[model samples]
Target: MGGTLRVNSLAIQDRRGWQKPYELTGRLVGIIGPIDRGKSSMVDCIDFVLGRSVRFKGAVDDQLVAVKAGMQIGDEEVFLHRSRRRLGVVRVEDLAGDEIATVPINASGDQQELSDWLLARLGLDDAFASVRLPHDRRLSFASDLLPYLHVRQEDIDRFVIRPQTSADDAARLAVAKLLLELINPASERLGARIHDLNNEIRNKQRKADQVRDFLNASPETNSGTLDADLDRLRDDETQAAQRLKSLRDRARAATQFAEQRQQQVDRARQRLATAEDGVDWALRRHREKATALAQIDASLAELGEVAAASSEDRERLALLYDACPACETDLSSRAVPTGRCSLCTETLPGAAQHKEKQQLQRARERLVPEVAELEQNVTRARHAADLAREQLALARRAVDEDTADAVTPYVDAITAAATELEALRSEITTLERLKEPHRRLSERQEEINRLSEELDQAREQQVRVGAELNEPDDVLQRLNNLFGRVVSEFRLPWATGRARLDRDTLLPMVDDQDFDQRGGGSRTAVSVAYSLTLMMYALEDPTRFQLPQMLILDSPQKNLGRNDHDQDLATRIYRWIIDYFEVRREALGGRYETFQLVIVDNNIPTAVRSGFDTLIQFKDPHGFIRDLDHPHGEPAGYEQLALDDELDHDGL
Candidate 1:
């Protein structure tokens, strides 16, 4: 059983920035007013605020920018607000009007959406339903239940249980099953598991098919030959490995021998470089000695020329000093001392000159022997250079001979071995590449087998859980009787007092005739009866059902005429509602205590007006938007309606 959801009030903000509040706290709340008075619009506000998808258009809807509802679920009091500008989010507030959390309108991930939040409060969070098939299950959202809870005027005469097209037919049935307690969490979980297993099996089978197709596309390989091919390839691989190893062994021995010969060649090259360097050094030393000897000879010749010049100069100076040239005085008879200068009458420089000549003579004597010794050394150095050159030539020849002997013979053998090994390895690699598709095919087949086993187990579990579904036939029988009784009261023209709910369609059938075969008014009567019957059934055992104790019907008297019979039927419908609420209240507690009903219509019959707990009425030019000057057309400054609403409710 879920907690009771009592809608306290609905507030609509219009383009004029005015919030029109309607109190819906009464058990039997009726919004009765003339046509175009926004009765349906008010119901839509409740729907929109409760997280139902509604396309807002037309005059009054265009003027509306936001809708808010204050509600009490169990012991919690909260306000839910939805803005037209922001379509996907609903703002939830606490009793103190403080913002608590913003929840998404639809289920997104693990986050609690508006539907889940409300369902949690109602103790129906675990309720689930299937859309098209029993296995295709999903959590039941508020929208799934809204079609049953709130019946629009247009749908009242057109549908028996809202056909919901092909997509949502299963959801419609699942909701009925849930309300009737024919399905529970355990059965739903098993069904969902079966659905998941089926999906996994399909996926695995698809992969297996793809792998099989790939294997078939290749003419040389298939699943049957995969093992044989692998065996042959492995044997060939082993032979190739052995051959490669033998080739490597032979190449290794040859490489060792070559390395030894290379070492000899390296030593010979080193010897050749040393001999060349020695030759160069010897030649350079010979040239240096020859140059030094030449320089010594040149110095000796210069010393001799200087000594002869000094002697000639001394003789000429002595003759010139015989007469003084400054005054033409001949001073040749003036006897100058041997160590005096004749011109200045000072000591003569002859002693210094003679000592220098003696030193020069001594140097020439020493240089003469050294020159002879240097000539001998030059000859020896040339001979040594010649010997080094000959040794260098021989060493180079030896190196060339060693290189030719070491590498040329092995080149062809090593290259042939390497080429053969590469070809063998390449063939092995190609064989391995050809084996890949077979491996994947095997893996995919294994997966398909595993998934098939799991799917079988899941199906067995589904059957076991499905067997536990309680009294589906008994529930349908009870519902059929309840539906017949409610339809009988409506006095529908097609009623034969033997009406039964169609088991498959879950719709009312009169005298074995389909619901769609009836007239408009009769259809409307059956639709209203069907909705009322569901509510009555839920009320019969509140603890066993998760349906909220609320029902909102818009214009149940939609197709009825102004005739006496038609009016009488309309009055009976209202009276039935009023009487039902009265019975429940008296049986339970006070009015507006247990179940809540809100009816939107053009007018509530005068006879049953007093039976309602709350009746809201609007006159001409007045509607849900009480202060709207223009109800059917765009008002002034309508473009700013959303902006004005945002500015006014920004704090909220």
Candidate 2:
């Protein structure tokens, strides 16, 4: 709501070559193309450049390599590029083509660098949503909103945000709540705090339980006997310490050598303890490095497997010649060309395969250096750990030799007193060790209480903040009104005036049935209506909603039949979108310049073609990539002429 994200242009580069730049800056645009003409691929470039993981179809995946988009985010203009040659990175550049930043793409995480940059520009950098639980939340990402903003053809006949699990559904709903202003930032922050408190309290409780179980299992010590045992050991230690002082005085007069040896033994024991700690620390570091190396190796293996599988699939598709495997179309009239695809009649050049191999090589090159570095670290850590263990052994031997030398000189004289004193001191040390568990248990319980109180306070504050926000009834009512209007205009058989929005699921409901329970055509109508309603509601009060003023619907007429009634319904749907655009354009006057809509379908009715500001149509044998025939890498400009003619026909 703070600003808008507009795609000004997009350029796609495949194995063949770069396509003509698509001018996408318009209030409304329609991408019309027959099947396999790369209509969806063109739209997917926008999504992929904007930070979405899109897996292109069989041939498209094999041929496509890179995508770049020029975007205007409010007052800022930037160019974004994503390439198959570079793994897990996106290149951001300024208008002058100077590098702005290289953002890393985390394979699995809500806090992505590119998503953060995009969300920050839209004033939603701090947005969050609850996932499995109310307190368990994750940051809202661009991918989370892409499903609603760009409705794919495959998803148009399902719910607006088709979730795979209950947790996914909850997360999507939480995002909706944030956009609708039903959940405020204060509440979200408090929820995070509460979640942290919960984890801390549980950890403390677990430690306390372990300590309690230890005390209970011990035969000589327990929580009830710790204080008594400590007091008894203290009395015995005092007596033994006095006797040892007397014995030391007598032994000092006999010889100073024994006293010096005893001091050496004490120093050696301290060194031994220090060496033991060093060994532990070095070994822990070694284990950590080894684990990291293992993870990197696993990643490299997975990347290799995926690349091999994709290449194999491409090869298999290339070898199919009996018939058009995809559509089973007869190829009897087509001559068997030496180096061309039977389906699309496009040239199959060896340079394209070489380019794919180069991409894989580049991706591997990026990770190989890191793997080598990790291997070196692991080897160095292991060597350090071994050296530390050797030092520990030397320290242990020194302690034993010094102890034996110190005791042999005055063995008979002080044996009875020294032995008795040693026994008392060892018992005291053992009792002290047993008493520490009680102290730790008490501390852990106290921490648990403190965290519990903080958790309660955090929950209370969250509740108070949530109560202050307005109910979403008004928003739901408005959505239902818009949805009903769209459904009626589409003339759905079950389009009763009583169509309402589900309070829990936020889905359209007719005759007490949810959108998912309806037929394919009805489901498509409901899904489209839901998206349009949300966009319209955001446009009405942009300040209250966080939704961007853009919508891209892919093949809204996908499942609709070819009958006259279905044809009229599809036409009416287009008309409704046109009318809504015109009304909003007049209402906002200048502010509506940011609003953009893109519809991708196989065909568009001639009557509504004039309503769009831009039209892109692709004929057979030509698609988003048009340089498939050039073995010497010459640009094919025929597709550009076709696009220009289509635009001229639309009077744009």
Candidate 3:
């Protein structure tokens, strides 16, 4: 089966997994399926052919897997491409439609020449890296460049570039622009030379002025005096510089010492604070314990009094029991001494019974004193906790006093106006320590001219620092450099460089400008524009991206919402992509060769659909895909889940 060029068509061989091998046709293709229906998987399949793992949810577990795809560009048909394996074995048909050349997925080790070849052919060799997404973290690639995404969110602001971003991100953007600019040999070579020559001119002029001024001002200008004076002054400057450096080092050390000491005191104070709270809690517990002890003691005291009185009472009662155990006076006292009348004399059982009762009473009486002692102990614990709290407070106070001494000066300085002399002192100290001390320029006219002339020379000297910014290196060599710098700077993928290119050499960016109501959509459009622009430039070189010679993006509108202000952003994305494609299309030739695009979406501006060669709509899948020719015609063993229902947490 040959590939489909200029159009995307699907031919599925199996439906084993969501990623089951299926043929896709089109340059700009959109696989319209609900999220998780394997839209990204198609992209992964493309990756697999390039010797990359098929990614799933930002994870790559199937590195061993391969993707199978077929393509037809114009009259040429290509087939049997596998991921990573035998990738370059299948070549792209050349411009003539009859010629063939092998293509590499990526270049390695001194493979710069080969990469350049591919990039040059694809129009991408010298393009910036691009932004590719599965979902979430639109801010991720921005991190590589700005350190802050927007101008307003930084730790400090020069027109804040939003927070969580930095100048590093701006550098990435610079790399992107520089990449595309360098693709035009004239632009690249001339830009670099202009930079160098400009520096050179300035330096020569400065040197010329210096020699003229010296000749005019000096009397006799004794060669020896000039030489000696210059040498001595240099030495003096060097020594002063060294002293300044030493003082700075000492100051830093002092600051560090104070900080460490303060930190220690702060930590101690925190501990004391916690201890004080604990002391309060302990005191409360102690109070409760003391109250309980007091109650117990009172009960014990009552028991003691009861026991003391009970002893006397018991003796009397004992006699009463013996004299008349029933207190009945033996029903009438012993004088009436009839054995029957004498209290129906049951003798109150034997002495042994009385002994048992007496022992029980004695045990109860003894508990009072011991209980009182325990209560006293609880009272003592309450007092001890109170004392501990006071001591902890005192310790905290002492730490505060000590820390206050070290920090007070800085605190006062900070609280006062920023114009304190200390601020100037700090600047002076820093400069002195860094001492490249041609810093002091004398104020007289002679000095001003001299310093200004010297400034030109210093700038010229600085030119030896790095590679000329713009040079016509081999196309892919330049691309790699551009992509590497862009990627490293923004921490984004090299492929995403396509998003940052421009047709008119103008740069697009977001800064302190007022935005429309559609924040999400506008941001998304900007992101898409940047990504798409870079790709368009890449496609200009046949040596870069491969055939089918075009790329398509779906739902660049994914995160946009149509607020009053943001309504135009979505429309802008469509118009921009269309305009970009249109421009590149004419440059390539009226009949764009080996390009296919299939965009699928339910909710996007109508303008996007109308601009495409074909706009397609298909009924929703309804449920899991089923094989038309199969037993029972059901989902086989797999079950369709209620996607929106509450999920089971067991495995999770």
Candidate 4:
């Protein structure tokens, strides 16, 4: 089907500091600038225009580059302006200009008139609406976008390849698979072949019965070794599959145990950090109180001494003497200015002494009262200090940072649970993966015993005979080659990625195989490894995909695989992702219609960037109304955002 996407135009509406609108044209898409020039974040603006249910996962402190997407559909040049809302609004161009009609996704209507009319004319499905705008947000959120549209990554696989894996599998599906299987082999006269086989078997049985009657008197023939051989063959195939199954089950259990344990450890760490913070807060409060109390005591002591010195003497001294409180001297006399203890002297100028005596009495009154108050305040300060010290000690003593509790039990429980789940998943993965060998074993077992007995009887009867079994073509070699090509220079511990061809089954089984046979730990580890790898594998091939092509990876490179093959595989695994994209584009005419890869850039392959259609360096710079040319400097190149006042309205 022919497809087209573009942003027709934009208008500048600068409001917030750096935010302005730019008219974006989708057809003229290309990388904008050098790495540091903010070429990576340009897509965020497209996302903003798409209604932010698909906003960037986390927070960004600054404004981001913003642009509104104006999409023009095919032939009629159908115009639709979508600006980040539920279902975009549609418009029809008439002589009057673009006229707003119904919603794009049709919230109120049963079907969108705009979409319906467009698809009907184009001979496409209703799904075409999903691809209309192709906002950067949609590009980044392939995973989340599934529910909004019927377009699925694994549709071909589920419907055409492995229908049985899904609930949709049924007798009808089996019929379809059978038809496809026959078609793949270029089978002719399959209908006639079934009829012929049934008739021939009947005839053979009838002829053998007639011959036995005629030779009844010859001898009673009983082949003893034949039966035993047949039994042995049956038992062997079942046993191998069963052994593999058992080993895989144990492995799955181990994986679950590890996951649960890790979760427990995380919780415990959070709890420990919280408890420690609480203790620190209390400690700080105690220290603050204790220091304040000490300061209070020092202030009290100083005030107490001044008050106790001599309130009566200070008042008397002010009148005449003005002597120092400690010295208790007189400065009333002009000649010497003082006498030792002037107030206490027997011989004196009696009337003059009266004035100095009065001053001393006033000083004593003020000093005595203040000293008593100072003594009370000191007592209070001492008590507060003691209490603060006691509280501080209790807080220090209670903080048993090391002895409180261990995350061991929680981790162990989590580990055990995770281990169990892991084992189950491993067993499941292994059983599912081993389809080819299991099928072969079943067919071989059925024939082995019968043939052995035939050989034995022939040795006794002097005849050699054999049975025939249809040998299904071995696609293992082809599968491995496909995986290797996809993996290219990958690095990860990988047991195997396989594809088996079977008339009874649909789609090739991928992921950890023979896990049960592999030890418990190995099986469990392989299950996890294989599941992830299979997911990666599917994503690599867009045509066979069931999920989004975009990848949201965290720190997955840490301790990926331990064994020789696994470790070696881990080294090149990430690079394989790049290769997968490259191959997809090469195989098809192009790359994913819309795909995104968000990750913590570590150990990233040097060549991976080429696969990325756009690199969003997530440092969020500016947002806009999508008017590219206005007053501000041109950001990401769309002519400068021009002001409305700058437009030549007079020409109109």
- Candidate 2 TM-score, true structure as reference: 0.59
Off by over 4 Å in 1: 15-20, 53-59, 62-66, 82-89, 102-111, 128-142, 160-163, 184-186, 206-439, 588-592, 627-652
Task: Give per-residue CA lDDT, model 1, range 248-281, as digits (tens).
Answer: 5765564464455556556666665665666566
List model 2 lDDT by residue over 212-323, tens digit each: 8878786676766767877887887788778777777755565554555556556666655665665566666656555544544454454454446545454322343546
Better of 2 and 4 by TM-score: 2
User: After superposing candidate 3, which stretches have Cα over 4 Å from the reference?
Assistant: 1-29, 47-54, 58-64, 71-114, 123-183, 190-518, 526-551, 560-652
TM-score of each: 0.61, 0.59, 0.33, 0.27
Q: Look at candidate 2 and tell me the lDDT of residue 11.
A: 88
lDDT of each: 0.72, 0.73, 0.41, 0.37
lDDT of 2: 0.73
Worst 10 residues of 3 by lDDT: 148-157
Best by TM-score: 1
Clashes of 3: 73
Any runs in candidate 2 off by more than 4 Å, and if so which?
107-112, 128-142, 198-445, 467-470, 627-652
Once model 1 is optimally superposed onto the true structure by TM-score, how far is the C-alpha of residue 494 displaced, in angstroms?
Answer: 2.7
Alpha carbon deviation, residue 634, candidate 1 (Å): 12
Error of 3 at 42 (Å): 1.7
Clash pairs detected, candidate 2: none
The lDDT-based order of candidates, best leading, equals: 2, 1, 3, 4
Candidate 4 residue 159 Cα shift, in angstroms, is 18
Model 1 vs. true fold: TM: 0.61
Kindly give the number of clashing pairs for every candidate: 12, 0, 73, 77
